[model samples]
Target: MAAGDPNHVLHVARGIEPTEALAVLGAKPGLIRTCELPDSKPDEWTSLPCAALGIQPGTAAALLAGRIGEWTFVYDDLGFTCDDSATMALSADGRTAATSVFTINADASLLYAVGGEQVEWVNVDDLNLEEDLPGMPAELRAAFEAAGNVPTEDLEPGEADGDIGMRAACALAGLALTLEDVRRIPLLVVPFG
Candidate 1:
């Protein structure tokens, strides 16, 4: 803790915004900090350092290399691709009613398989349950509860892919796989906000 650091206790205990916490400590709003980016971009802003925004080297490369809109991102190495910013996410249960089975690759990369099917993510890391999942879609959670663990063979060949079945088996054994298990897991891990 420093004399000018935002009072973490006050911020957490009072449930006040970091800026307000800084105000209590008599720090400038501009100088007070948060790990999350500003929800809405400011109309007028000064260019900050690339390191300041804290983006991943790969993602920054995608932006700088002009591949932000292409299928050429590192995600290819992990085996699946997305044409759009994802509209839904899987719960830690690693299941989704979407068209693909999302899993994590050996290097902790993300992977996916597409086909209209009941999908569940997998982990090459271990057959363990995850302690945290960034988020889960409402539908995915609903479908998981409805389906339960009905055995992979019961899912059928056209029902889902093999990778999903393996992942589900691991989940059944209490493992938690992460999106990063697939290549290019969608997170800006470099730095910022």
Candidate 2:
């Protein structure tokens, strides 16, 4: 998938490493294997042949992770890493932000946590309604509004409001990714049971 494609993006602050982030998300160290995918898109990594990778079919899980500036970004195809406990664990040292988009159902969510406490959680589609995002910081609220302002005509076929919201959240968390970046960067292909 491209940069803003439908997927879950998790950002952990304070320069956490990929392995460390995975640990915080509860991956067993012995089960985690790191590899490089020099030729595949981030989304394709999830469909990797488990047998060939020496992992059982039903037990395999995958995610792409990398550090950008002072934050670590984890790209989860299944969107499971955005749960409350995981977010709190990831933000224990600083902050964590997650964005999830499921285009099939038009479900999109953004979550933010700081110092192990959740601060904001909102549906991207409801961003325009102030009452929908209680306790959200002024800067983040502004970012969400700005991201929602893009004209529908300007977005690509599969892109939607959620993608824009994800980008805004990533930017605020000090991440800047593009299709090329996803392709060229040697992000750790973290596979685990």
Candidate 3:
């Protein structure tokens, strides 16, 4: 949106290189907020470079206007709980992963079983719209609704542990990125399968 508005805004970016991703997403050069993630133990859901995006009035409209397709990942801070942040990971090779509750299905069991898994990449626009939203599992829909439109200041511990988080991680790895690179980012790798 407008520069220096002090309201939360979405960063719509794509590309493998971080700079390119921001450029493709039409990012404005400003001090957008970001969270720092510490090192995690093995078998943990690490962080993304850009995790939660602050949302304000017109945020949704901004996102829609700037969309590069479903290939674009949307991140925002949900006010209800401390753990409602989400985003997507774009790798150096044009591969992408999503972790936003709006992007991935957050099923605990599905995540545990598919952790670290990878598959062929697909364009977000190629997805069958008829089979997409209506086909979302009940758990995913509930999580999406529970993480309503609000921002929070509460701090919660631990990495994002859930099916959605794992799905994002797997999607990141699917991009053929190194674990070291993956560990440094604050994005959520939304799974396509």
Candidate 4:
């Protein structure tokens, strides 16, 4: 995914706050910067260029785009247990939102999602058996287990393009019929923190 576009975005229809969803993903608070605007007004607040925040142009556009009530972002060491950090955004009503992690490469990316019918997430490489592991099906568990120790540093150019990570997430999210399936679902590509 591009620097500015969130690695994943979840549009919660009901029963959860955006902050609650972000917290579920292991995001903590500290030195984080934010931009808040009226819910019905997008341009009321002056937006910073994506480059200024070290984000992709597309990401900047999405975060700063129309009618969002609030937009907060930060990338700092906030006492997180993992080596991960991300730029996050939440709509004023705590429904629509997105997250982007700039430091992780394709090989080490972990995909996760929450606030839907199922709450699940998985490591594109090594998924934690102990966690809730949302959307994962019983049949695909063995496949992911068999592909253990998958390192992007060892793969061919196109082979490391988050295919495995995407597959695991799709299964966990119940969005795929097979490992090869590719649907346009929003995924949070969090690295091990």
Candidate 5:
């Protein structure tokens, strides 16, 4: 989508302030005027960040993204959100978590599970992606960059509560990591039959 592409234009709805709502879709300054509005929230906005979108108790997506280029894929009532790669820690309650969303299948459930990676000790120097799009922290991004296996236990205690938080998961079989080093991996707790 070019700066002025038609499909790339902001899709605003009533009370959504057509010209002003473009920021919610990350459109350029002048591009606001070129928006082709929709009757409701755009189909592209899968899951927006509640904290980043300024979601109030009684507010809806329309009011939320009216002016905010809302962060999507954040942990919410929605289950199991993550970046492109399924790397990261889980919530204390054992839910699949992420700083953003990917191709999420809404019906799937996590029974009792945790995340792990084939690699540990990710090189802290090589991770570079679209930061402007919002994502997980660099520390968690680095821990999974090494050569190894997954760790099902003892993920170093870290923070997986809010966006940009981390929790470590130490290696179990051959995974070499400290408590503060496991956030670089993706995890969940799915109950097995």
Candidate 6:
């Protein structure tokens, strides 16, 4: 929930390149900015001060994206609120999964879309996996079930249940970020409106 930590994680199905994904998210190609990940471990990238990357704290909207196996993962430090129509557009051709968490306001949601249509939207924090998991997409439900056993074990201090659920959804959507994966992949930095 820190300033530079990811607040929104979006996954677009494989075959959609980072630029294309950004286009879907409303980023203008000419206006977009690019930056290389600092010469540091991948895990350290998120923790690095935003100023190091020229991101104005609490003002600029930037997105870092990279392809990972079956999906392209887009990480945003500031929670970019996309409306339902835009969310559906991002998944027009294939599948898309988006997870957002804003701990300061206790707000979070996991959204799944396929072929330009929304299939699921879950208020992660309010979910009681035991009662709601069955209605979610199979992959997401399974992840949530797996995460239910040890909710806060892997989380940093002060993280909420919503963070756990959001992470589970992201992982299920092929966003299980790892140091090596992050290191080898060059993320595209796109300036968002």
Residues 1-193, model 3: lDDT tens digits = 1222112222222333333444334444353324333343222121122112222322332221112223333333221111112222232234433332222232222111111222222122222323432454444333333432222243123222332332432333332235455335454311110
Candidate 5 Cα outliers beyond 4 Å, as residue runs: 1-90, 101-125, 128-193
Error of 6 at 43 (Å): 16
lDDT of 3: 0.29
Residue 151 Cα positional deviation in candidate 5, in Å, after optimal superposition: 32
**For candidate 3, what is the TM-score?**
0.25
Clashing residue pairs found in predicted model 4: 4-56, 4-59, 5-59, 81-193, 82-193, 83-193, 120-134, 135-172, 136-172
TM-score of each: 0.18, 0.70, 0.25, 0.28, 0.16, 0.77
For residues 1-193, write the lDDT of model 2, one tens digit per residue.
4223333444445556778887887666776555554344334333332322444333544566677776777765545565677777777866555544444355776667777888877666655544543456875666555555454864554334555656656666666566566545546655543
Please write out the lDDT profile of model 4 over residues 5-108, one tens digit for every residue: 22333222123333443454454433122333222322312223233234433322222211112322222211132222221212223332222222334333
CA deviation > 4 Å runs, candidate 3: 1-15, 32-169, 172-193
Extract clashing residue pairs from model 6: none
lDDT score at residue 5, model 5, on the 0-100 scale: 11
Better of 2 and 3 by lDDT: 2
Return the lDDT, model 6, position 48: 27
Global Cα RMSD, each model: 18.1, 5.2, 15.0, 12.2, 18.9, 4.7
* Model 1, residue 116: C-alpha shift (Å): 21
What order do you get sorting by lDDT, best first? 6, 2, 4, 3, 1, 5
Clashes of each: 21, 0, 18, 9, 29, 0
